[model samples]
Target chain A: MTPRLTAFNVVSLTLGFAFLYLPIVLLVVFSFNESKLVTVWGGFSTRWYAALLGNGPLLEAAWVSLRIGVLSATFATVLGTLAAVALVRFGRFAGRTLLTGMVYAPLVMPEVITGLSLLLLFVALDVDRGFWTVTLAHVSFSMCFVTVVVQSRLVTMDRSLEEAAMDLGATPLATFFQVTLPLIAPAVAAGWMLAFTLSLDDLVIASFTSGPGATTLPMRIYGQVRLGVSPEINAACTIMIGVVTLAILAFSIASKRGLAEPGRAEGA
Target chain B: MAEPPGRPAPLIRFEGVTKSFGAARAVAGVDLDIAQGEFFCLLGPSGCGKTTLMRTLAGFETPDSGRILLDGADLAGVPAHRRPVNMMFQSYALFPHMSVEANIAFGLRQDGVPRAEIAERVAAIVRTVQIQGLEKRRPHQLSGGQKQRVALARALVKRPLVLLLDEPLAALDRKLREDTRFELKELQARLGLTFLMVTHDQDEAMAMADRIGVMEKGRLVQVGAPAEVYETPATRGVAAFVGDSTLIEGVAGAFDGAAARLRVRAALGASSPEFVVAAREAPAEGSAVTLALRPEKLRLWTEPPEAGTPNVLEAEVWDLGYLGDKTLVRLRLPGGGTVRVSRLNASRRPEAGLSAHQRAWIGFDPADAVLLTR
Candidate 1:
C-alpha cells in the first residue's frame, strides 16, 4: 500500500528536521571556516582544528572527561546489572519498593536538582570536590539509564532456561553465571554504551561538583563560550559529536554482525 | 513384567502429600507407590493436580504436610538439583543457545564427570534416541520430533533412579507422539529404570503405562491397570473420566448375594427400565446407584433377540459416527436417555446395516456392567 503523504505532512517534516539539525550543521560547517569572523562563511580550511590541537587546558579537560566516562561507565554497568537482576529475578523482599524507586528516579529527575544535591552531599560529607567527585556524580545518575535498559531485557527473558540449568544439577550460582548471564549479555552491553554516552555528554552535574583544575570538556567549552563565541569551541564540539557518533555506529554494527553469524556448533 | 500384588519395595512413595498455593489446594492428601522398573502414569484432565503431584516428586515444590520417600529415604528438604531425579519438562526446555550434544551432556558436566566419559555417553544416547546427524543443530533448527528426542536423550543421559516425564510426548504430532510412546516404553524396559509420567491424554496413558492412576479434584480416584480401570471403575466420575462410557442412574430394588436389581427411570418420567446388574458389593435397598457401561460392551442389533434374552433395552439410533476402525452409534433409549454403543467394522460397510433414527436393540451381559454406589 502506498503511504498517504499530504502536502502539510511533507512541509512539516522538512521544517522539523531543519529546525533540529540546522544549527549543528552550521556549526560543523563554520568549524572549517578559513576566516576568523564567526558568521561570515569563508573557504574551507582546517586552521581551527590546528589551533584546538595546541590548546593545553582543552586537551587536559578532554583527557579528564575521557577518563571519567570510561571509569564511571564501567562501574555503573556492574552496579546497574546487579540492580536489574535483583529487581527482575527476585520475586519480592523488604525494601524492594524503595530500591526500585532509587534505580529509576534519576531518569526523570531534573539535572540541576541532581547536580545541586550531589554538591551538597559531597560538601556535607567534607569530601573535597575534584576529579573523584565529578566521576562519582556521573556514575550515580548514568547508572539509572543502565538499570532501565537491562531491566527491560531481563523481563522478557525465558525464565525456564535458568530452571533447566538448575534442574540439570548446577547450583544456583553456577546457573546464573552459565545460563542467565550469557542470555542477557547483549542487553548489558547496550546498557554500558548508554551509560558511557550519558556520562560523556553530561555538563551540569560535572560543573556543579568539579573543583579548580578539574574542568571537563563541556565545562571548558562553556567557559570559552562565556568569554566569546569562537570557531575553536565549535571545532571542539564537532569533534566530540564525531567521536560519540562513531562509537554508537561501531557498537550497532558489531551487535548486528554478532546476530548475523550462525549459532556456533560446539561439538562439531 | 508382572510382580506380586503386594507392594514390592517401591522406588518412590508419596504418603499424605499435600500442597497449597494460597487458599487453593493444588495437591491434596495423596498416597501412592511406584514400583521400581515399572512404567506408571498419572492420567487425568487438565487442572486435575497430576502435574503438581509430579512436581512434588521432582522436588520442585515442598509438600505442606507429608513425606515423599525415595528408595525408602525421606525426601523432605531436598532441593530439586540435589534429588536423584530428573524431569523431561512438557515444553522440552532445551536451551536455545546450546547444540543438542551440549544440552544432553549438561548434567554430566555438572557432576564433574570426565570429559571423555561425558562425550562417550552423550554419543551413545544420541544413537539410542536415533538423533544421529542432529547433534550439532540447535533446538530451534530442529523439528518437533527431533527436539523431543533430544529432550529424551538429555533426561536419560543423567541416569536418574526414577525419571519423571511431564507429558513427554505432548508437544509432538499424533504420528510422532505414537512412535515416541513406543520408543519410550521400550527404552524404559531395556534400561530397567522406573518411569513415572503424567499426561492428560487417556489413550497415551493406556498405551504406555503398566499401571494408570486416574486422578480428579486433587485426589486419586482409581489406580489400576488400564483394563482394570476401564472395566471396573470405583465411582461414576472415574467411569466417565477414563474413557467413553454411558451412565444409567437407577435405584437399587433387591440385593441378592451376587446380583442386585435396579429400576432405571427415563428422564420424561414415562418409561421404566429394569435390569439386574452385577456388583462386587451391592448397595443398600432403596438407595441411589449408577451403572457404568462401556460403549464397546453393548451390541446393537436391528431385530430384538429371543424373548428370554437378558439385559436388553430398546433404543432408537440418534447419531451414527463412522470412525475408521469402529462405528460409534448413539442410541436414544426408551427412557429419553442416550447411550453410545461402539461396533468394530469387521468388514467393509459393516455398520449393523443401521442408520440414524432406525429402531435398534442394545444388549449387554450383566457381568460387563459395573454398579457404582456414588
Candidate 2:
C-alpha cells in the first residue's frame, strides 16, 4: 500500500506480463519470415501463411481441430454450467462433495494420465479412436475449465434474481431460463471461449485418442515439429494469437455498449 | 414473469408454513394472509428469516410443511415461473446482456407473450418507473437508483400477484435510499398491488407497510400496525431488533386486573427502576423479567428532583453525545448501569446547563417502560 510497495508491485506485474507474452510477440514476428527455418529471418514475407494454407494435410487437420474444438466447447459449456448450478444451489443428498471433486479432477490431473486412461476406457468399450474420441477427451478437460469458471460466477450472482422472477409469475424452470441463465450468460460465454482455446491447443490427448485421418491441428503441428521447426508453425501461432486478441476486444466492446451511461455503472 | 395488475385474487398466503436448513429452522409455522392490494413488510434483523420467508414466497424454497396459497389456490410443487409473482431483487439483478427494454420484456418473451404486447407493457412500466428514455441502456450503465427502477419495471411489467422486494434500498447512499423508499411506498400505493418486502430496516418497514411482521430467529414474533408494535412489542427480540432501546431486566412484582404492574430491576448495576406498567403479560412477583425504555422517554435534570419521582435515580453525567437537533446525555446511575436522556437543543447555550461528567438525575413517566417476560 505504500508508494515504494506500489512501485514494486507494478514492476513485478510488468515483468510477469513480459515474461508470459514476450515469447508470443517473438513468435508473431518470426511468423512473417520468408525462409523455411524459423530461427533466421531471411526476409519479410507472407509466404509462410500461404504455405500453411496450402498444405492439404495441415489444412485438413486444422479444419478437424476447429470442428472438434467448437463441438466440445459447446458440450462442456452446457454440461459444466448445469453442474455448476447444481453444486452451488443444491448442497444436498449424499456424495455432494465427492461429485464436486470428480467434476474438478481433470483440472488438476496430469493430461497424459487423463488421456491414457480415457483411451484405455474407449478401447475397452470397443469405441474406435477418431474424431469422436478426441472430442470426448477434449470435453473431459474442457468441462472442468468451464465448470470452475461458471461455478464462481454462479456463486457470486444474486440468488434473489431467480426468486424475483418466480415471485413475479415464473416457475422454477422459467426462472432458470429467464433470470438465472441470463444473469450467468457472460460467465457461460467466457467459459465457452476458454474451453475452445484449451481444446484447440490440446495435443497429447488428441494424439492418444485419435485414429488414422482424425489428427487434430495440434497433433499435425506436433508431428511437423518433430522433423524441425518451420515458419509455417509460426504462421499458425500468429493466427491463434489473432483469434484470442479479437475475442478479448469484442468482449470489452460488448460490455461497454450496453452500459454506456455514467449513472448506470452498477454491475448487471 | 411479474403478473400484470389485473388479477382477481389475493396473491400469496403462507399457511402454517415452516422451513429448516439442516438443524437450523429459518421460518417456523408462519401463517400470513397477504391481501391482493396490500403492501406487506417482513421486518427483522439478519438471520431472522425475513429473506428466507421472501424466498419461499418467490418459490425459490419450498416449505418444510404446510402450503403456500396464491390466488386462492395451492402453489404446491409449482415452479417460480408457473406462479404469478415477481420480485425486485435487493441487488437489482438486471440482465447484463440485455438493454433495459429487453430486460423488462424478458419474462414476457419467455411466457410466449405477443411481441407487441411485451413492447407496450415494457414501455408502460419503464415510463411508470421513470426510466423511459433509457430503455436502450443496459443495466451496468445505470446508477443504483436507476437500476432499481429497471428492476421494478421488469418485475412490474408482468403484473404478478405479489412484488417481493429484498432490501431494495439497502445499497444506495443514505439520501438516495431515503428518497427511493418513499418512491417505492408511493408506487406500491398507486399500483395497489400486493407488495411484500423483506427488510432489516425498521424505519423503511414502518414508512411503507400497511402492517409490519417482525421476525426473530425464523419466527414471526409480532405482526401489527407500526404504532401497535412500537407501543407494545410482543417479545424482547422484536423490541431489540426493531430500534434502539434501553433494556432493563426485572421481576414481576404485582398485578391487579385494572392495571397489571411489573417491578423490573435495572441491570446496569446500581439500583433498578420499578417498571410501573398499566398492563403486561407477566406472571406473579419474583419472576425474572426485562423492560425496554425508549431513549426519548427519559427526562434529564441537572438539579436533584424532589422525592416524588417514583422511579428516579441520582446519576453522574458519564458521556454527552450531541445531535444537531438534540443532545443525548448518558448518565451513570447509582446502580452501575447508564441511562441515555435526550433533550432538544432549543437554545444553543455554550454550557447549556449540563456538561459531560456533571452530576444529574434521569427519570421517566410510570408508563414509559414495557415489561418483557423474557
Docking class of 2: acceptable
Cα deviation at B158, candidate 2, in Å, is 2.6
Candidate 1 residue lDDT tens string, A47-69? 99999999999999999999999
**DockQ of each two-chain model:** 0.37, 0.36
Q: Could you tell me the C-alpha RMSD of candidate 2 in Å?
A: 5.5
**Candidate 1 wrongly placed segments (more than 4 Å):** A246-268, B1-7, B260-272, B333-335, B350-352
Residue B182 miss distance in model 1 (angstroms):
0.4
Kindly give the stretch of ten consecutive residues in candidate 1 chain B with the minimal lDDT sum: B260-269
Q: Write the per-residue lDDT of candidate 2 for residues B1-374, one digit (tens) a residue.
A: 24458854445678888999989999999988777788889999899898988888777788899888887788888776676788878777676667888878888877889988888888788779998689898776778788888888888888876888888888788998888888988888898888999988899998888999999888888999888888788788877777667777776776665555555555567555565665545576687777777788887778988877767777899888888788877877776876777787788775477877888887777687766775
For all predicted structures, in order, the TM-scores are: 0.91, 0.82
Misplaced by over 4 Å in model 2 are A1-59, A108-112, A118-129, A170-190, A197-201, A217-268, B1-12, B254-276, B280-282, B307-309, B346-351
Q: Residue A57 of model 2: what lDDT?
A: 89
